[model samples]
Target: MKTVYIGTYPPRRCGIGTFTQNLLQAMSGKDDSPKSKKGFFVVAMNDFDQEYDYPEEVGFTIRQECQRDYQEAAEYINLSGADCCILEHEFGIFGGRNGVYILSLLHRLKIPLIVTLHTVLKTPSYEQKEILQRICRTANRVVVMSHHAVEFLEDIYDVPKEKIAYIEHGVPDYKFLQQEAKKEFKLDKRKVLLTFGFVSRNKGIETAIKALPEVVKKHPEVLYVVLGKTHPHVLHYVGEEYRNYLIQLVSELHLENNVVFIDKFASQPELFKYLYAADIYLTPYLNEAQITSGTLSYAVGVGCPVVSTPYWHAVELLADDRGILFDFSNHAQLADILIDLLDHPEKRLRLSRNAYEYGREITWPKIGAKYNNLVKEVTAEQLKIPRKKSIPFDIKILPPFSLAHVKRLTDHTGIIQHTKFGIPNLKEGYCLDDNARALIMALMAYKETKSQKALEFCPVYLSFIYYMQNDDGTFHNFLNFDRTFVEEQGSEDSFGRAIWALGYMLDNAPNDSYSQIGKYMLDKSVPVFDNLRSVRSIANVILGISYYLKNNMGDDVMIERLRKLTAFLVEEYRQNSHADWKWYEILFAYDNGLLPLAMLHAADILKDEEVRRIAFESMQFLSDITLKEGYLSIIGNEKWYHREDTRSDFAQQPVDAMCMVLMFYQAYKMTDNIDYLKKLFASFMWFLGENDLRLSLYNYETEGCFDGLEREGISRNQGAESTLAYLISYLVVLEAHKNYYSKYWQQNQTEDLTSNE
Candidate 1:
């Protein structure tokens, strides 16, 4: 397809200009068919007194301050036989207040138009808001880099959800060569912290400079590198005032030995080199409404551990231990975080790995394909042809296995309880609840990838489990920071959960030592299962017993215990389940799927067909309740569903979605029905924004999932349980895809042989 891009093109030192150039290059690389020889074209935007040596791809040009230039460019594009036009929109890049002059070109354009918004203001002035609304009304599709931007446009600008597409800001695929670059840059011993981009007042370089003195006090060889020259507009208006002020601040703080300035705009190669040489990247921008950040994207792409103020872009990118975030202009917090990271190279390296893995999805090549796909979809919509919605099914796009957040949440003793907005809350101490889940998740991850990192976590978590066990075979759920148990006997749920985790490790442990430890723990916990009162706790113990029975099948004691627990669960269902109520309880609560799932496991282990039928029936009933409108509508925790009360629909947890995936997969296996498999994937897609809010719970940049989905938006906190839930669900989907593809391949091969015969 012939596509044209309109934006500020290169030789102009603008972020949008570089973005348009990179996007066009990537798109052209993808358009390799012989029939499309010309590749993509660009209609470069220029200022009144500025001009670039235009490349061969430039089909036209528009003077930003000239209104008539826009109309002329549109007419030229119409006559140029291009199939569609992509407008790389930035307010200041276009002429007129809020860039309203671009409306003239958009109005006159005969071909289809796709507008990629570079800046989405959360709170806009009257003219800015009106211009954006008009653009949305005029364009076939609007592209934004962040989910936050999508929400702002839909909620504040009244843009239709269908018209907006969320595409991440593109970054170059830079290699990670820190040691080589550091040696080349003659900074072999220095810990380089860098902030690169045009030096505008809003860039917040002073904040980093202010924080550097304290950082330098800890590490004498610390270097704060401020790269890139003053912005062209800033230069034209103020003449290097911001740069000079930052320099003065560095001198005043007595940080001259620790601060260096590279006062020239770096080329792409030089930028990559500097990024590779740096230890940590910093972006302390002042604007909270700032929507897109190319510098931050580049830093992340190269895998530099980042320390950024919580701007809109930073908040989305630095989440979930991908990097460290401090309050805006809070230099003390910044210094503390920086020093802590520098003091601990292992933590810095972990953060870098997470950032790099996350950046793979947003590289220019991947982003180019997303843009191309959007263009095709918009083109089809413009021509009024029916087209299927694009569903992301590529397992490769899933985040890589990184234990950065997991490690961050854990101490030598155990994983901490709740985090205060992604930061580990040391005051809350450790919890048996999270540590149990952590051990299971770590074991599963190790089984799948055989990752040494995953294996390292096993001993720590196992030790925590052993430490929490009381003499009576009960467990303490909570412990203070001082390592003293806070409760005499933990809740039944905690005890049962610990049993479940132990059983899982017993069944899946890679080595004999782990197996033995797991067996010891399971043996201790089996006697207490009969005393559990909560239905959920009993259900959890049943699952544990089922795992134990898998290996030690002839153990009559364990088998009898499993049978008794199964009887109790069945009795609960008989009392609570009726014509309309198909659950074991009057109200559906957290981890509801585990109840039915345990029944399925027990039915299989005991060879009881009646119990098996009941398991399927109840699971199907729950499925019907959740899978509405072909998407997973998890019962919200804000106010759960009751027998006679309205079903609440906000604050849906990741645990719920995760439970459905496991349950549906099990059902698919038991019935050999494809419908269950379809449900499995559909429910998993809830994390990918195939739900009510249409916002993704998964953050590709951090390899972390947000805490939960809410009525208005998603929870920004990426805690342990949420991250583990997403990882578990992702692993299930990956395994299912592998098996399905392998089977399909074999079937095809067999069919070919039959056809040949």
Candidate 2:
């Protein structure tokens, strides 16, 4: 089975890149199985603004920080006919918080995936842990280099043990002549101690430099060679400060003659020759947190006598006298160990012998064979699990309808406005806008699935609306948990949303008691309609009046109220709109599609041709801006699209997606246009990861949705408004599938037959 490798690739100057290149080489020409020809290629990751002349084997290249590139790369991999994908996962190599942008690619992949983790921190940040856990969930098998990482995955990350495969870092399979390599480097007369790989402050090179002076005092011919360039990232930002400091330290210690710096990224042959030339390998890493050190692995694989700090990898690799370890930053201890090993030729030979014996098991050929078998196994297992039909309109991919998260957010009072993660953050108290949304969501949930829990909460949310309304027909937006209003009056937006909830109840209420209560609240709010100046407020009031008229079509007073609201919305569009901008406002802000959604509702109820025309035109305008990419890119709240300014691409709110879904569904319902139905599905998919960042905002684990899509990643906050928006969109999509999709197709079939006749 052919495999596509996703990671940084040569000649990118990244350790992960080198590892991937080596793995690809090892696995090449090894596929003899009949299932398919075993082969490998790469999907190289390019750092920001840095490009490479990649080889033909690199099927695709993904710019690290460009989010769309990841999705496109996944598409390329899927179409490449690769049976399985192996990803080299490192936190810093990919884009977004904790390298979350990789998730988009991983999620879209159709084949089995195996991820080899390069770093596994014991105490990961919130985003880091989330990203890793999500990665583990997506991968068929997770590979880690060290046993400590396997335990960390199980104990800390809660990954299933069965899903983890421990694979040691592979080393080059080549023989080296130490004496000849030493002579070639002109270090044959000296005792050579070497440290290689990208140099950075964290490597503790100064500790080794300080220890060298003491070692040189006893063995005057001792030489310490520092190899590899400064870490590219550190060099880019800090500009060789650490490297300069190390040079100065060597000079001040009067050990300049004993220390030499080789600042180049060595090829494998060159690195292996240097490894054999050294009597000892020094890894003075300052921390014990390193789960895997490729340089250290290479040193051991070459059978060099190793002197290193007790980093996690060193401790495990040197447990059985394979190498010696010293305390971190304790140069004196390192010095003593070095002097003893240099003096005792037999002891050094024994360490080398033990390391070589162990290294044989982890040579590149053996490690490559293990990975090849794993790929075959994962492929066979993947074939056993029935695949979902690859149809865009399949509703089978939708999560089962549930109100568990909504119930978690709601209380006896009402659904809480905000949550920290999935837990309700009562400190934020409650808001009328969210409660109004919660009421509509609950009604739709009950209407679609007849969920008893949804019907049970309808009264609870309606009660919140009742408690927030003032005697004067205005409503207080905020309320503390103490059940007291915190404001005298709410924004026009909140009041309009309250009307929307009440009107929706009048139309789709489960019983007469709810209808009476909704009618009572909506009738009292009608007097405040004339005062609604915000275009959003007028639009929302129109939707409420239209829904109300769905039940009481002959209510002339309500019809007049709807006409006045529609007129107000139309006048706003007439004043602000031009040949270029077909919107009801000067700029695209939050809930941008609401205006057209309201217009559609008014046009359907009024049966006015001009109103219907404008409604479809504005809906198309919104669709052009948001769905031009064939997926919803909600107008971001961060510096929204001004009349002539570029549109900000992040901080995409869920409410905008929900509004588009509603508006398009309404348009499809009126016109039976299949295009609108497709757009509606795409808008709903924004929650499921088809947006700019391509990260799903809906949290299936908690059944709650994240607040929005921000520049860094999905916002961690799962607030009521966002969750309600997702649930409402989900219900609407289901409604379209049930009431429109099959019928539309059947109607098309009938039209085809009629034309033939």
Candidate 3:
């Protein structure tokens, strides 16, 4: 139990100040028990009476609040994590309004109050009892120091008896008492008599003094110390008549030595000394309402034999054994108990011992134990109560892309409508069947990772290639020459394409429809080239070089022929293209991908050192001149798309063109040259970095993302070829985390390089 004393200590005066001062000193006097709280905190009012500090030895902690800011205090209290509060209640000092601040504090704190009422009147005014009633209704328990207090509250304040407790004030320290104590107060140097506290008419000091004459006759040297000031309020309430009257009676008794009028105020320590010096302490109070005289309690608390009022408080505490309670109506008889106790030094010593033993129990340790239990109960209940997630919705893609952790709805699939995919220029009735395209994708899947299925697509077009073959080895022109079952047309141009494709697969394609077609191509293709090996044999040259690509045969026959074909291409047709479908196209386009890629590889492997240099120079030349202004353009000249209704730059650019560019990027990756890498990345940034629409290039139309960035409502080219092209570019950047991040991603600039923008 943490002790929180709710009183007016530092910043004010009145009953609360003095009461709290005494309380703090008593509570601070000893160490609290281990099972109990230790700190004695004071929550005081500040500003007008702030800046007061309590000694640490006194265990005082402070909480401050302004007069009108109790609401703020209440809210803070509600969450303060404290146990219980101790309130000092009084009608006058609270400034009325039924002490609503305390009520507010209790409701917000949700804790109990150990209320100590200063006054419990038998008949209170309307405003007085209203305040008391309000405080009583909110209190968990009430601490009344005397029986009269308990009775007055039960009847006048309407507080329930079960809520009331009687815990009397403890003894003041004897050290203070020893200072003011007198030896001759003892008769035969063995008797001492004292009366102390604020003097008032009803306190019966006059009766005590008058009775001292009879007391001294029995014990002649007995001394009565009337040591305390008259009440400050007595002048207004009843006048100085009582003070003058008591002074006159002291003289009339003619026992000046025995009835000493030491009527001056005393300090806290001095008051205790008078009580300790006395063998008998008397407070024969006449007023019925004086239930608790702190001075009276101090006397009995120090175990001095006491002759006090036969009143509600005296009967309740001094308890008929610790002290002698006498009838105030018979002052003469009340003197007899004091006279007897003074004569019996042994009896006085016994009473003093009882008070000291009991006073030690009320030491702070035991009192603090009472406070700790209350805190444990309140906080335990609070902890048991529960509190509600931060966002609450459905998820599509989960973190980590794992099935165990992810939640997915039931409709996702890989295949989609042909329109959704990227096949451009479809005639409504003449669209390529997915059967043809699916085979390509399936083969592409295998080619992507060499998983044994590119063979499937290789056969799919095998029959078409063979149907175009011709006799005399000149080959088909516009259509198939062997159209025995259909119309006649020839495409000898397609002959070289078909032969090159078939021959490449024949040597190393996984054993399946692909290799069989390779055998068929080789069986028919060599003769067409051997007879002429000119334009038609250009296909032979492609086929023969592929044999070199597939194996290190230690034979130069096919490789020498390929060199001758290259010579013929440069010497003859390389000067100009025949048409859109030109042999020169095949010349440049061969080794366009990794196989063309392997041309250099083959040269390296076979130690065809001259060929390796040629391959490197040619590839580099192609990438350089054709890569227009940081972008790869398929047309050797810019004029190719100039005459069209929609230009390559404006309309849907075919995906294959970008794919070819990525192929160059791949070549650059192989070369590791800064120039190639720089151009590649700059053109690629038209996608999302600091360039062109500064947007998604794959989704680029002539305008923006929609319709692949359309203009004039034209659908932009966002086809499969484009998608793959962008993906390839992304891979290039991703593969070089260092270069990509430092150069572009991190906005780092190099001295020799042109700015990326």
Candidate 2 lDDT over residue span 1-757, tens digit each: 7889999988899999999988887777443233322356889999877989987778799988888898899899989899999999998899988798998788789999999999999998756777788789889999999999999999999999999999999998878899999999888998899999999999999999888877888898999999999998898899999999999998999997899999999998999999999999999999999999999888889899998999999999887989998899999999899999988989999999999888888888789889999999999998899767534366887888778888898999998999998899999899999999999999998888988899899889999999998898999999998888888999999999999888888889898999888888887888999898998888888889999999799899999989988988888889999999998888998888899999999999999887898899998888888888667888888896899999988889999989998998999889877778888899999998777766678886788899998878989889999999999999999999987757967989999999999
lDDT of 3 by residue, 486-601 (tens): 32433433445445545545554555666665565556665655444344336334543554345535546655655555555443434443434222333433223322333443
Tell me the deviation in Å of residue 459 in model 2: 10
| Candidate number with greatest TM-score | 2
TM-score of each: 0.54, 0.77, 0.42
Worst 10 residues of 2 by lDDT: 29-38
Query: Which numbered prediction scores highest in lDDT against the true structure?
Result: 2
Q: Is candidate 1 or candidate 3 better by lDDT?
A: 1
Q: Give Cα distance to truth, residue 517, candidate 3, Å.
A: 99
Sorted on lDDT, best first, the list reads 2, 1, 3
lDDT of 3 at 708: 34
Error of 1 at 289 (Å): 8.3
